[model samples]
Target: MVVGGSLGGLAAAHELRAAGADVAVHERSAPRTPAHGAGIVVRPDIEALLHRLGVPVEAVAVELYESRRLDVDGRAVREEAPQWMTAWDVLHRVLREPLADVCHRLDGALRRVRVEGHEVTAEFSDGYTAHGNFLVGADGIGSATRRLLDPSFRPAYAGYVGWRGLEPESRLPGDLRELLSGRLTHFTSDGMQMLCSLVPGPGGELEKGARRVNWVWYVNVAERDLPALLPGRSARRSASFLPPGDVPPETAERVVREAEASLPPALAELVRLSDPFAQPVLDVPPWRMVADHAALIGDAAGTVRPHTSVAASKAFGDAAGLATALLGWTPAQPLPAVALEHWEVLRLDRLVTLAGTGRELAAASGLGVGAGRTFFTGD
Candidate 1:
């Protein structure tokens, strides 16, 4: 049984079914793509999963040739190696389409997980219950299963938020039209940093004029100011993210002004014209990933900063590793803790390294400078 029906849970179910095991996924929220999302830098691990699942590389993916660091005037300081990047929406659709025929329980929240002897039973908010040999938690960073297992686990703030934007190629000013196409560009100065790259347009359009240029800017947000930066109906949801128009106009304008004052001309223009969105950069620790017959995977396992470009890859790795461990283990068989323990040991190391690298880079004085590549290079 799998809890959460996002990419992580879907991938887990996919891998398990491929390994000849019956799987069922339960999701708390509606099974639909979120309106607010960001871009992801795809790595080989995710590519391998796609190939393994026979999911073709559709036009939804955009190739990046070089990452160019620019000066205040948009002049190149240096160029670094490139990689492929895609939108969260595109990958979600690709992963979900194949599972259309899979056993999915949408809009069902897991209220309780009861372990009796060797069997684990999951009770949902919809009055439905499921019995399985093992449970996989793919419910994201705020996973209920993770909370039930380890109450002390909480995401540590990185002292800043990753301010992101998705602007269309067509809407761009004529002067900056060729600035970010076919390349990942960035600007860094004083303590401010920003990066830009092309991602597939809406519905994964690959055409030059139809694509979207994605950018992210990191800025300090003191703990006291977080409540103001994040505006919800109630202050309790400050930890949650806020989309463009929902953010306070004053705060949004201040962010745009900061971008204009700190970033290069091209990036500043992109930010000025973008629909702003903000997500706090967080660090997650190595929690008890496996408790008896239950396992925590995906963001539920670790929420690393996005600098490493391993967010989705880690999810794929978790799914692949868990599937391999349960290769022929059936739901009717006795659940073994040895394989789950081994899987957690292997997963924690990678998660710790990725989180460490992201925090270090984020704290570096010259984060976007030096053409330095320290994380997830397959190195």
Candidate 2:
């Protein structure tokens, strides 16, 4: 059974079914249409996973060139690396086709796990229970499975928040338009950093009123300030919960005004035009990726900072690896701790290195000088 029916869970279920196993996915959210972020950068590992899952890589738009531009006070530096930017919804749509046969139980929030000698059962908040040979937690960062298994593990705030939004390419001012029209661009100075990129839309190319430019700007703030910045209402209910719209009107106005005062002109203009949204940055220390018959994948397993642009790839890797291990499972040896341990051993080193690299690069970007390409290049 796969707990959490997002990309990781869906991928895991698809892989298991291909290997001739019956799979079921339990998700907490309502059965609404799939929605995701503006775009995602696909790496080699993610590409390989998609290929292995019988997904035609060519069906999805792939950005093949390596274009990296970093600017500080208008002076720029450039480098090359293998990268592809594709809309998140496009990737999800491609993956969803193969998972049609899999049983997806929506509105089934995992409340607790019951692990007996050789079998595991999951109890959901909606009074449903599922029995399976094993349980895989792809439940994201605030995973109930993780809490039940290891309550000691908690996500630590990363000392900053990422404010992100998307705007049409045509709406940008002339100077801002020229700076961010093509190529992935970044501007960094004095504890502030901004990234803007032209990413393909659902329609593929920008013909007239079609394409969008995505933006993510990072700024450091005290942890105490987050409550005031977050939307005053509960985050669990709203599907697209964001700080500006959810907070009191007066507070929201003040936050926008403050952002305009502190951010650069191009970034400030984007914010002025954008319906602002905020995501609190957080990182998890490495954990034993497996415990008993259950294993954590994706954000639930652990998350590194986004500076490395490896979170999605790492989650894809986890799903692929776990599927491979489960293929050899037999009735006599229902769950093999050793096999899971091997997977954990392989991932731990990479996670540690990535966390350190992200922290260092974030610190450097905060200091005004642009960071070196080591983090992005994986060197």
Candidate 3:
């Protein structure tokens, strides 16, 4: 069983089913329309999962032909390979296509989990109990599974926050469209890093005029300002992020003002006209990932800072790794714990490296590994 119905949990459910395992996803959150959760840089791990599920993903993403860092003269420092950009909403849909035969129950929040003999049992908030040979914690950064497994682990928050915005491609001034729409652009100043690229519009509208420009500005925020800054739009402090529309008009304006003062003209204008939100940059340590017969996947395993841009891909990697191990193990040699162990061994190394790199980039305030090279050598 997978807890949390977002990208991680759903991908875990999909991968396990593909490996011929009977899977069920239990979500605590109420079922609702998937909002454009956040913009993501599409990587091969995500593409491979989509291909395996036969989910058509071409229409769900905006193709970016280049990536470059800007110099003081406003010229590109260097250009790199093309990449695809899309929203979490689109990828979530892609992962969910194959779950029709799998049990995906919403509002089934897990209240307690324990291992009895060789079986793992999960008690849900709705008072439902389920037993399985193995359980996976694909929850999220605020993962209940992680806490239950190792209460000693806590996510570390950086001294900075990522301010985000999404604007219609057509809404951008015509002169800036060509520079920003088909490419991922970056600017660094005063130790702050800002990036902008295009992504498919809501519902995956790929037309030229229908696409959206996505930007993330990493800025330093003092501890004293956090309470006011975070609650500007959302009334409560997020363990991770405050989604759009919760940001107050005045606070969004201040963010725009900062962007104008700090970012390049094109990105600054994008922030000025777009609806905005913010999420704290968090650092988390490497998890054991596996405890007894249960495994932690996605953000549950480790919260890689956003600088890696693999938050979703990392979850897919974990799910895919676990699924592969389960698929290759023969019944005669079947040891659920051994398979989980192997997967955990491989995932821990990866997650630790990612967390370190994320910290480095966040430490640099967003300029490190901005080109997707340091984070990924191959899928």
Candidate 4:
């Protein structure tokens, strides 16, 4: 059974099914629709995985043939490195379509997990329970599985927040549109890093006029000011991030003003015209990703800062590792403790290194203290 049916859980479900395991995905909420989830840098391993699932890659993705770095004055240099970009909404659809045969239980929020000698059971809030040999927690950063496993573990808010926007290509001024088209562009200043790229449009259309420019700006926010900066939907304080339309209008206006004052002219206009949202950068350190018959993947296991841009790829890596470890396992048998241990060791090692790298990058970028490299590397 997989808890949380977002991209991570869905990826886990797909890979495990490919490895010949019967899988079921339980989601705490209803199915998601596109909320301009923004762009994702496609990794080769992820592309290969999609190919293995027979999902046509190009139809849902846009190829970026170059990368550009712009200064505050809009002066820039370009490199011929090529990478594919896709909207988060597009990727989610493709990953979800292949899992039609798998059981998907919606609104099935997990309440507790029970483990016996060989069997594991998940109890949901609605008084429903499901038994299985193994369970995977691909839930996300606010993972109930992680909390249930280790109540002491809490996701630490990094000293900054990422403000993201998706501006329609047609809505952009001709000059600004031309400047951002067909490339990944980056800009950085003290305590801030910003980037933009062309991604498929709302309906996953990759045509010239149908595309959208996706941008993200990371700026330092004082810890004490977070409550007012991000007013949550409920009385509870905001957790990791806020979705589109959740950020207050005044905060969005303030971001636009900051962008105009600090960012390049074209980039500032992009922010001014687009609807911007914010997510507090967070680091979720994992004490242990594996516990008996259950394992945490994706943000559930650990979350590095977005400066690394490895969140999606990291989730896919976890899914790949878990599927490979359970290659011959079935629900009829007990969970393979030895194999799970091996997988956990490797995943843990990588996550620790990745988290350290994030801190180093954050420091170098002025989001934290100390000196380090600000290079972006893949998972």
Best-performing candidate as measured by lDDT? 4
Question: Which regions in candidate 4 have their CA more than 4 angstroms from the true location?
Answer: 33-36, 232-237, 331-334, 369-379
**Candidate 3, clashing residue pairs?**
233-246, 233-247, 233-248
Give per-residue CA lDDT, model 4, range 1-379, as digits (tens).
9997887788899889889888999988765633546577778657768888887678888898898999999999999978788988878878888888889888778899999866889999878899987889988888999989998878887767788987778888888888887788989888788899889987888898899888898877766767777874443356766777666677778788888988888888889998887777887885688888889999899887777777788888889999999999865676777888899899989889888898888777787422322211111
User: What are the models' TM-scores?
Assistant: 0.90, 0.85, 0.89, 0.93
Give one digit per residue, the lDDT tens place, for model 1 in 1-379.
9998877788888888888877888888776636446778777777877887676555558888887888887778556576788988788777788888877888887888999876889988899999987899998867888877887877777666678888888999766768787788877664556788888887889888888888888666655667666774333354646665566667668777777767777787788898787877666676767787888998898877777778878988899898888786765676656786798899998899887887676667333223322211111
Candidate scoring better on TM-score of 1 and 4: 4
Q: What is the C-alpha lDDT of each candidate?
A: 0.76, 0.69, 0.76, 0.81
Candidate 3: stretches off by over 4 Å? 33-37, 71-78, 232-234, 328-334, 366-379
lDDT, residue 153, candidate 2 = 71
Error of 2 at 107 (Å): 2.2
**Per-residue accuracy of model 3 over 1-379 as CA lDDT, tens digit each:** 7787898788788787778888888887778734544788778888887787675567678888878787645767667658888897777776777677777888766778888666788998888998887788887777888888887878776667778877788887887788886788998765578888888887789998888888887776654567777784436777677778888887787787777766777667778888888877766677688777778888888888887898889998999998887785443554666667787888898888888887776666433323211210111
Q: Sort by TM-score, best first: what order?
A: 4, 1, 3, 2
TM-score-wise, the better of 1 and 2 is: 1
RMSD of 2: 5.5
- Candidate 2 colliding pairs, count: 1
Error of 1 at 243 (Å): 2.9
